[model samples]
Target: MDYALKESSTKFETILGTALKVPGVRVDREQFLLQTLGSKIKDGNIVNLAIETDPVTAGIPIDKLDKIANSLIKKRTTNTSMLSFAAGMPGGVTMAATIPADTLQFFGTAIKLAQELVYLYGYGEIGNANQLDEDIRRELTLYLGVMLGVEKSAAALRVLSTNISKQVVKRTSRRALSKTTLYPIVKKIGAIVGVKVTKASFAKNVSKAVPIVGGIVSGGTSYLSMKHMGHRLSETLSESIYYTDADYEKDFKEVCNEVVDVEFN
Candidate 1:
């Protein structure tokens, strides 16, 4: 790997590790969703599930996923915000360390939302951290970059989608992805997303330091920011080529070389 790509990968791992360590970050809802989706993938029941749940989601429309993402974020933000405020209030001093904790909550929520939306859009199960294949992992990273509004990642995703549509296999795709030509873009994406997360965390810390109404302000800020990130992910991922059943099945069979029986009901 290039130096920049290696550095960005390290930063990504560190940030993800920190986020996973936060209490209440891995909520039951997220676990349930993942497990359910994983089971669906294993059983090859995704298409039926999509049709039974929402016919429109067969294409994974951005607006529909956006609504779901908004609901998910709204449901969790209040509790996370309060917890963040309490964590920061140490001897009447808002410790900077608490910022990471608060940000981790948001990161966890954002990641969960991203995964759920991507799965619903027909990207298949993003398995557990240890179980994720390199292709799927890279796809998730690309989605994260999209969630962070990285234009280069977005453009790359489009190209990737085109390639998948052409039935690119895993080896060929991996080779292209591993090329130095793409390393710079991937590195840039990681840097941009990392900076955005850091900046957001800092702003939350500043808002939480207010005297009387700090908690309220922090809560509001967290709510809006989390919702914004969730919507961003939903918008980008839902509209992706991978959202359609046909496209997803094609990619899954060709790229992953797995026979996924898609049941349309």
Candidate 2:
């Protein structure tokens, strides 16, 4: 059992790497902001200016950002759910849990949602989302971990978010986060994810007995899961942090007890 747990956890890390390769998972902050606000903002340069600087710093209202984030979450949720349903169909090419194409796409979509929400809430460029370096990995882990309701990960994010606000220069801030501060948290996340994977409950829950039913379960599960995770990250970014509200922590570390209903092996 312990061996299976370790192997599954190791595979979870690889699964994330594969997810990054999914197109559109890596969101460009400027492009996303421009596209999201373009039709509404009207003025090209003003929108450009907003993208260059933090939206909040450029006087974009918090309520406006919230609207954009909600739209993004909805769109991504629908997309992920559809993919999950398709993958969940029994005898589908990627139905096997080992490969779990739907699971990969789900994370990919979730990452994009996370990026958009982070940008909308006024965070700086989080580095190459595609590249997924150590810092980016740690950052993404924290965001996903928060969605999974990990306490230590949230505390790490709180500290990192505060430090990001204090950063006068990009290099200096990146350097600060690249140290021992976040490593332990990342390790904890790895262990947790590993356990989830080994239990076969990490991906979207699909009932294999009834082919169509599996699709329904997969799709429905993805939609609800993504929506909640998106909201969790959104709230974390918006409140209980230095980015948006003066007091962001209004229960910033709080997470849901049940994130999904996947069956255990």
Candidate 3:
């Protein structure tokens, strides 16, 4: 074992083992610390049993133990957050923005997870990209029904991030993921339907919502609501219908007729 590697691991074991020796935290003997921080291999061989950081030897000067002690004391003292020292302005806006976009991406995971499931089931059955969305929404609502009121933050974040990633995948180019095109589609749906529609919802419902309508509203709402919204919008505006088969021509014309002849009576 490399000298540095062995030394660091020993120090880490001492610190952590000491902490876990307290009641309520059982340390796994097999996994120990290496599982969290993968095995370190050097020169084509496993060099150390574990690796870690130790404050004692990290920046100590061997010649002057007294100076080294003072340096360690200063390092620890200066490392406290503003909130601990005396909260005032706190960290700057740039510090907040510096957080990775991938980290914040969890906010939309629910949509992403839905998309992945749709892709797994069969995107071809959903028709175009829009129809695929309905399928995703239909399935997602069913899944979320089980987790509606769960208060676990980590679980919620994972679900939401997966959902968002799935939504972004569709309408994204074959070569690259891009939400730019999908956002406009959402805006259009929001405008015609008089509700805030999102790419995630589109991905969710496109498969299950018939040719155009979907479960953007309540999970229990009849399919008629989605079809009606699509029917009205189709009549109000000139649109293009892209389908896997020319067979949909009849269905398209029927939808148009339904919109034109619509009556409350």
By lDDT, who's the top model here?
A: 2
Per-candidate TM-scores read 0.60, 0.78, 0.18
- 1 or 3, which is superior by TM-score? 1
State the lDDT at 152 in candidate 1: 53
Question: Which consecutive 10 residues in model 1 have the weakest lDDT in total?
Answer: 256-265
lDDT of 2 by residue, 1-265 (tens): 2555457557767776677777768888888888888966767776887887777667667677777878888989899888878878766565235656676777788778877887777777777534347667667777777776655556556655432432122332222333453454465565576565444444445375678877888788778888998988887766643433322332232211111111121
Worst 10 residues of 2 by lDDT: 255-264
* Residue range 161-252, candidate 1, lDDT tens digits: 32222112234333232333444455456666766766666775677566446666666676666666666766655456334445444433
Ranking by TM-score: 2, 1, 3
Once model 1 is optimally superposed onto the true structure by TM-score, how far is the C-alpha of residue 147 displaced, in angstroms?
Answer: 2.2
lDDT of 3 by residue, 1-265 (tens): 3344344334322322232233422323223223322322222112122222211122222233233323322322232211111211122122123221111121122222222222221121222345454333322332222122212211212222223222122332222213342222222222222111233223334433342222222222222222232222221111111221232334334333333332211
lDDT per model vs. reference: 0.52, 0.65, 0.26
Lowest lDDT block of 10, candidate 3: 235-244
TM-score-wise, the better of 2 and 3 is 2
- Which scores better on TM-score, 1 or 2? 2
- Can you tell me which runs of candidate 1 are displaced by over 4 Å? 1-12, 21-70, 76-79, 91-99, 128-138, 160-181, 241-265
